[model samples]
Each structure stands twice: as structure tokens, then as C-alpha cells.
Target: MVSIGEFGSKIKENISRVIVGKEKTIERVLAVLISGGHVLINDVPGVGKTMLARSLAISLGLEFNRLQCTPDLLPGDVTGISILNLKTNEFNFRKGPIFTQILLVDEINRTTPRTQSALLEAMAERQVTVDGRSFQMEKPFFVIATQNPVEFEGTFPLPEAQLDRFSISLTMGYPDEQSERKLLKGISDEHPITSLKPVSGQDELDSVLKQVKEVEIEDSVLQYIISIVNETRSHRDIQLGVSPRGSIALMETARALAGIRGRRFVIPDDVKETACDILSHRIIIKPEARLMRRTNRDVINEIVESLPIPINNEKT
Candidate 1:
């Protein structure tokens, strides 16, 4: 039997066959998968953002469903609507695309804000409410939404509320020449993604998620996370800070990172590595701050630098 670590590596290798020069992005995708958390892939077109999501779904052995967001999309479209069953003379709920274990929402920003907000409930709760009824989703559910960063022609940017629901947001930057060369050499007239197979089953995924939960963090690290959130809230250039749920995402992602490193403990590095992806999307800078040309990366760096690094047991 292959160890889980080996299995994880195989999954990464399989994905890289299709998406070149993105080892870190692959690891982030894996971390979010094992963490059982949703993700937002924000990048320019033709950068393989959607391909990454599809590759991940195939590699992880999860059921994949994709929706191309458009202005015509309705809330009932993503989350199934209730209807009257003529024979039974009663209303019955039918599941939508979001019902699957792995859902890829491609070009999510292409849809209207009203249609986009419809996902807020599903992404955050992992369930849908229809006709005044709530339904719980099965285990191993996750959403991987993609957006084109360079195009604003007809796109509606995700609101801060919906953005906070994602555990991480990332861009798939251009591949290096060597990586692109390798990618060009791998073609056999068919997409590599079709040949890809799952590295682990949903059961294995659930087990790994359990392991992620087992990873522990010290109280000092908890304080560090809080300090960062507070700083963002009080920053003169910022209009909003990460919500409590965002703090939870940071803590959860830190544990998942530690687990990926084969450890049952978390350190400050795990938190720092995840802070930007986790917090940047959740904040909104003031107009003056934006005019000052300050970026989300800058704010994240400043907050991270201001926090005192915690010493481990050796310091005590």
C-alpha cells in the first residue's frame, strides 16, 4: 500500500503533467483539498486556472461539476429549486451542480452580483436552503471558483462578503520557459487531464482531513492570528478586516499545512505562508489607500511583520 505522502506526491505529479511550473500552486490546491476547504483561483485568462481545478478534481477522485457563470444564471440554477410533483401532489427538492463533491465555478465573475451572491449560502454552509428548507451536503464537499483578473469588460468582482468564505485565493502565473517546453513536449493529441486518475478516494480524503484537524497550534500562534486580524481592522488604509470566520480559516489552513509537512504541530511559518491568500481577498482598502498605490500584498506584509514571532518550547 502506498503511504498517504506518496499518494499526495503522485497526485501532484499527475496535475503537473498538465499544469507546468506551478509546484507551489499544486501544493496549495492539495492543502485546501486535504483541509476540506473551498478556494478561489483569480488569474488572467489562458493561465490554466480552470485547468488546475479540473486537474485537481480528477487527481483527487472527487465528483466534478462545473458551471460557467453568466448574467442569465439564477440562484436556482446553481442550487436546485423545489418543484411540485404532479403525481405526489407535493413539492420535492432536486439537487443542483453544487451537490457534487468537487465543483468548479468557471468565470464566476461573469455572472451578475445578484446571481453571485446566491452562492454565499452554499459556499459558507456547505448546504443550500430552498423554499424555506435547509439541506446538508455530504462529506468531502468543496468549491473551487475561478475568475479572470485581466478582464473587466463584463465581469462583476466578488464582494467582500462572498470572498471571505473562501479559504484561499491565488493566481496561476505564467509558466517558465523550461516548464512550458516540457508542457509542449508532453502532448499526445489528447488532454492529459482525461488520462489522470484519483490519487486518493473520498474516504482517504476524509481521513486526511481528520489528520489535518489533529495538527495542533500553540496559544501564542493563536494570539498572532488575532493580532493580524485586529491590525487589518484598525489600519488607516483599510475599510475592513478579516472576519471571525476568516480567522478560523487561517487556523484551519495552518493545521493543514503542518499536516502536509508530516507534522502534528503548527509553527508561525505555517500561519505566515497562508495569511496573504487567506486575508487579502477578505479586505477592502480605502479609495485614498488605493490611490496611494498600496496593494493587498503590501498590507499583508506590514501586518505580518508587525506581529511578534513566537518562540517554541526551547525559549522557555
Candidate 2:
């Protein structure tokens, strides 16, 4: 079986053909998917959010589907509908893009709250309901939903319930000067994404994902994760805190990160590294905190830094 590190490296190298100077971001996204969690990418347009999703799906050899969300997009459009079969005279179910292994929801905030709610069940349960029937999603299902942080004009902010369903939220910032230069040179007459290929097959990915769940973490580290979540609940400037789901997400992603780094045991650094991205979106800040320019990231960072690391690293 291929090691997790090797699998991650191959996927990252293959994706590098299309995306530039975002190794850390790629690693985090890979970890989230390996941990069986969806991603919420909050960023400005033209930063390769869609391209990144496509590259990752291709690298993993997953069935990829893109849904460009609009205000008019409906629940049935995302989850499919039941239609009458002409010959059989029975209602036949037609699958939507949500049935795919990897679904990229572009400009998700532009869709109505009703349409947005359609994804909640799929993201949380990996299944969709139509005509009072439940349909199970195939294994390795993942979502990479994107929203423009700078533009709110016809966009509806994701409700707290929707936000909490995402395992990790990140921004793919603009690449550095050298990487941008390489990007420009690589895209003369043709795009690099057109030539990208799958680095590993589904079986290998499944094996690696299984191993990620088996990655070990000490009891001390687990308590540390709980402490971080607890801090958010009582923080003076915060109106809401990270939920238990956020804690689980942090631990799961940390395990995946450890596996990706070729470690059988998770350490403090793994928890610390994955905490902000996993917990930031799950938090709700007060109006006063926003006026003070204190973002969720700031509060998460303060909590993470103020907490003490587990000195006991010996695995049980």
C-alpha cells in the first residue's frame, strides 16, 4: 500500500501543474477530504478556488461535478427530482450533481437561503431526500463550496447551521510574485489544468483514508483540544463559540495531518495547525467585536496561543 505521505505528495505535485504557491492550502484541503469532511473556501474571485477543486478531484480520480450557484437555483436543481417514466408510468428519480464524489459549489452565497439549505443534509449525512425517499451518497463524497468574501451584493450569508456543517474554512489568497510569474508563463495558449492527470486511483485513496482514522493521539492532546473549544464559549468578546462538532473536526483533521506527514501519532502541532481553519467558521462574533476589528481568526489564535501544550508526548 502507498503511504499517506507519498499519496499526498503525488497529488500535490500533480495539482501544482495547475495551482501555484499554495502547498499548505493544498495539504489542508487534502487532510479535510481524507478525514471525510467538507471544505468551505471563502475568498475573492480569480484566485483559483474552482481550479483547485477541479485539480484535487482529478488527482484523486473522483467523479467531479461543478454547480454554479445563482439566486434562482432551486432545491430540486441541487438534489434532483422525480419524473414520470413514459413507458413504465412510474416516477423515476433523476440524480443531480450532488451525487458525484467531489462537488464544487461555486459562488454558493449567491444562492437563496432555501437553496443553500438543500446542501445541509447532503453535507452532514452524505445523502439527499427526494419524494420522501432517501438516497445514499457514494463513499469518498466531499464538497468544496466557495463564496466571495468581498462581495455581498446579491449574496446571502450562510446561516450558522450551514457554517457549522463545514469541517474546514480557508481563503486561497493570491500567489506571490514568483509564483504568479510562473503561472503567467505556463498559460500562454492553453491552460495547465487541461493537461493534469490523476496521480493515484480510488483504492489507494481509500486505503490512505482508512489509515488516517487510525492515527493515534494522546489523551493529553485530546484534553487540549477540548480546552480550546471551551475558551471560545466564555470569551469576553464572542457571542457564540465552537461547538462539539468543531472539536471533532479538529481532532479528525489533526489525525489526517499526522498521517499526511508520515506520523502514526498526532502531536500538539497537528492540533494547533488545524484548529483555526476548522474552528474559525464555526464561531460567531459579536457586533461589538466586529466594530473592534476582532475577527474569528483573531479570537481563535488568541485561545490557541494562550493554552498550554501537552508536555507528555509518549503514546499510550
Candidate 3:
């Protein structure tokens, strides 16, 4: 069996074939996915943000599906419809692309809130409900939803409820010159994604997620988690604070980070390192604050800087 670190390294290399030079983005995606959490890739078009989602799906030996969220798109379109099978004299449920292992929900904000709500249930419960019936999803289910950061026109902003459903939100900006040059030269009759293969099958992926749950953390880490969340609640730059669910995600992601590093225990660095990604998007900024030129990134940095570090890592 491949070690957890080797497992992460192998998967990173597999996706890098198509998504050149964004190792950090690739690693975060892997960490959140293996941690049994969802991701929101925030960036512009033509940046391989969508491609990264596709590459990860391909590398994991999972069924991949892409939903181009648009104004006319409806909840039924994403969750599929319950149609009557005349021959069988019954209504059989035909599942949508969301039923797959990796669902690349491209341009998610373009669709109306009604359409977006279709995913809230599945994303949170790992199941879909149609005709008042709930169906369990396959193992290793993940949602790598991507959105355009610059375009808000005609875009329906995701509700805080929907946004909170995601575990971590990140951006994949333009790669450096070296990676862009490599992308151009590598194209022949095949795209880089075409030749990609899974590093390990679904079974292996499952084992890694199971191990991530077992990663331990000390009491100091728990206190650190509380302090960070508390800061978000009292910070003057924001109106709303991180929700309880958001705090839970932070702890789970921290543990997963520790496991991926081949350590059985988590440290303050893990929480501190992933704090921005894990908690930034969950914050609700006031309109006045936005007018005053404060970004969530800025507030996150301030909160992180103000916190005192743990003197000694005490075990729980």
C-alpha cells in the first residue's frame, strides 16, 4: 500500500500533467477532498481552474461530470427528473451529473438561487432528494465548484448557507511563464488530460480518507481553533462571523493536513497554515466595509497576526 504522503504526492503529480506549476492549488484540492470536505475554486476563466477539477477526477478513477451553471438552468436540470416509464408503469428516477464521484460545477454563480439550492442538500448530506425520496451517493463523492471572481453581472451570488456548505474556498490565478510555455509545447493531437491515469483506484482513496480521520491533535490546537473563531466573531471589519459548522470544518481539515504529512498528530501550524482557506469565505463582510476597501483576505491576515501562538504543544 502507498504511504499517505506518497499517496498525496502521486495524486499531485497526476493532476500536474494537465495543470502545470500550481502545486499549492493541487495540494489544497487533494487535502480538502481527502478530508471529506468540498471546495470552491475562485478565479478567472482560461486559468485551468475547470481543468484542475477535471484532472483530479481523472486521476482518482472517478466518474466526472461538469455542469455549466446558467440563468436558465434549473434545480431539476442538475438533480435530474423523475420520469414515468410507460413500459414499466412506474416513475423511475434518472440521476443527474451530480450523482457522479467528482462534479465540476462550472460558473456556479450564474444560475439563480433556486438552481443553486439543488446542490445544497446533496453537498451537505452526500445524497440527493427527488420526489420526496433520498438516495445515497457513491463513496468518495466530491464537489469542486468553480466561479468567476470578476464577473458579478447576471450572476446570482451564492447564499451564505450554500457557501458554508463548502469546506474550503481558494483561487488558482495565472501560472508563471515556465508553466504556460510547457502547456503550449505539450499539445499535439492530445490534451494533457487525455493521457492522465489514476495513481490509485477508489479503494485506495477511501483508505486515505479513513486515515485522515485518525490524525490526532493536542489541547493547544483546540484552544487555537476557538481563539481564531472568536476573533472572527468580534472583528470590526465584518458583520457576521464564522458559523459553528465552519469551525468544525477547520478542525477536520487540520487533522487531514496532519495525516497527509504522514504525522499521526496535528499541530497549531496546521490550523494556522490553512486558516485563510478554511475560514475566509465563511466570513460575511458588511457593505460599508467593502466600500471602505477591506477584503476578506485583509481581515483574515489581521486576525491571524493578532492571535498568540501556543508556547508548548500540549497533548489532549
Candidate 4:
């Protein structure tokens, strides 16, 4: 069996073939995968958000499906609909793109709120209901949704309920000068994703996820997580704080990070490292804070920094 680090490294190396100079971003995405949670990639256009989702899906050997969300997209288009069959004279259910293992929702914000709400159930329960019948998704179901941060004309901002479903929200910023030059030179002829192969299979991925749940988290570290979450609720600049789900996400993501680092137990550093990614999107900033140009990330960082580090003997 391949070690967790070795397996993670293989996936990263495969993805890096197409995505350049975003190692941390890749790892955060992998952490969400291992934690069995969805991700929201919020960035400007042409920053390889779609490419990252595609590469991860290909590297994991999962069935990949892309949904180009637009204002005209409907709930039935994403969750599928039951149609009458002419041959048998009975209704037959056809699965939509949401049935795939790795679903990339491109420009998700472009869709209407009703269409966007269709994904909430699937993201939270891993199942969708059609015509009063619920269908469970296949194992290893993961959603990688991308939205353009700078565009709002035709986009509907995802409600807080929908945003909370995503375990982590990250930005794939513009590549550095050297990496950009390399990207321009490398993709001139053909895209590297065409040649990419699966580095790990479904069974191995299941094993990794199982192991992530078993990673030991100390009491002190647990309290540390709670402290940060509690701070968000009482903070004057914040209107809403992290929920119980957010705490669970933080713990699960920290465990996955520990597993990725080849550690049997989680440490304080893991919680600190993943705090922003897990909690940032779940928080709602105050209107006053927004007027002062305060961002959710900044509030999360302040809470993380103000908390004391838990003492643990585990070595990273």
C-alpha cells in the first residue's frame, strides 16, 4: 500500500503538470477531498480554476462532469427530471451531471438562486430528490464549484446556507512571473491535462479518508478549535459566526492535513493552518465591518492569532 504522503504527492505531481506554482492551493483542495467535503474556488477569470478541478478529478480516477451554469439554467437541468418514455409509455428517470464522482460547477454564480439551491441538498446529504424520489450519489462524490469574484452583473451571490455547505473556499491567484512564463511556453501547443492519468483509485481514496478520521486530535487542540469558533460569534465586527458544522469541518480538515503530512495525530499547527480555509466562507461580516473594508479572512486570521497554541508532544 502506498503511504498517505506518497499517494498525496503523486496526485499533486500529476496536477502540477498543468497547474503551476500553486502547491498550497492544491493541498487545500486535496484536504477537502480527503475530508469528504466540497470546495468553492473563488477567483477572477482565467486563473485556472477550472483546470485545477479537472486535474484533481483526472488524477483521482473519478468520473468528471462539468456544468456550465448560466442565468437560463434550471433546477431540473442540474438534478435531472423524470420524462415519459414513448416506448414503454412510462416515466423514466435520467441522471444529470450531478451523478458523477467529481462535478465541476463552472461559473456557479451565473445561475439563478432557485437553480443554485438545487445543489444544497446534494452537497449536504450526497443525494438528490426528483419527483419525490431520492437518489443517492455514487461513492466519493465531490463538488468543485468555481465563481468569478469580480463579476456580479448576472451572478447571484450564494446564500449563507449554501456557502456553509462548502468545507473550504479558496482563491487561485495569478501565477508568479516565472510560472506564468512557463505556463505560456508549455501550453502553446497542447494542454497537459490531455496526457494526465489517474494516480490513485477509488479504493485507495476510501482508505485515505478512513485513515483521516482516525487521526488523533488532542483535547487542547480541540479546545483551541472551539476557542476560535467561539470568538467569531462574539466579535463585534462579525454578525454571524462559525456553526457546529464549521467546527466539524475544521477538525476533519485538520486530520486530513495531518494524514497528508504522514502524521498519526493532529497538532496545533494543523488547526491553525486550515482555520482560514474552513471558517472564512462560513462567517458573515457586519455591515459596519464591510464599510470599514474588513474582510472575513481578516477576521478569521485575527481570531486564529489571538488564541493560544495548545501544547502537544506530537511531532509534525
For candidate 2, give the lDDT.
0.92
Give me the runs in candidate 1 sitting further than 4 Å from their true place.
1-7, 314-316
Model 3 bad stretches (over 4 Å): 313-316
* Best-to-worst lDDT order: 2, 4, 3, 1
Instruction: Give the 10-residue window scoring lowest on summed lDDT in candidate 4.
Output: 307-316
The pairs that clash in candidate 4 are none
Candidate 2 local lDDT, residue 88: 95
Candidate 3 local Cα displacement, residue 308, angstroms: 1.4
Q: Model 4, 1-316: lDDT tens per residue?
A: 6666777889989999999999999988998898899999999989998889899988988899999999999999999999999999999999998999999999999999999999999999999999989999988889999999888898899999999999999998989999998888888567888999988998889888777888888888899999999999999899999999999999999888888888888889999998998999999999999999999999999999988898776554
State the number of backbone clashes in model 4.
0
Question: In lDDT terms, which candidate is top?
Answer: 2
- Residue 23 in candidate 1, Cα distance off native in Å: 1.3
Between prediction 1 and prediction 2, the one with superior lDDT is 2
Please provide, for model 1 over 91-169, each residue's C-alpha lDDT reduced to its tens digit, 9 standing for 90 to 100: 9999888888878899899999888887888777777888899988767788889988778898888887878788999
1 versus 4: better TM-score goes to? 4
Query: Which sections of candidate 4 miss by over 4 Å?
Result: 314-316
For candidate 3, the clash count comes to 0
Clashes of each: 0, 0, 0, 0
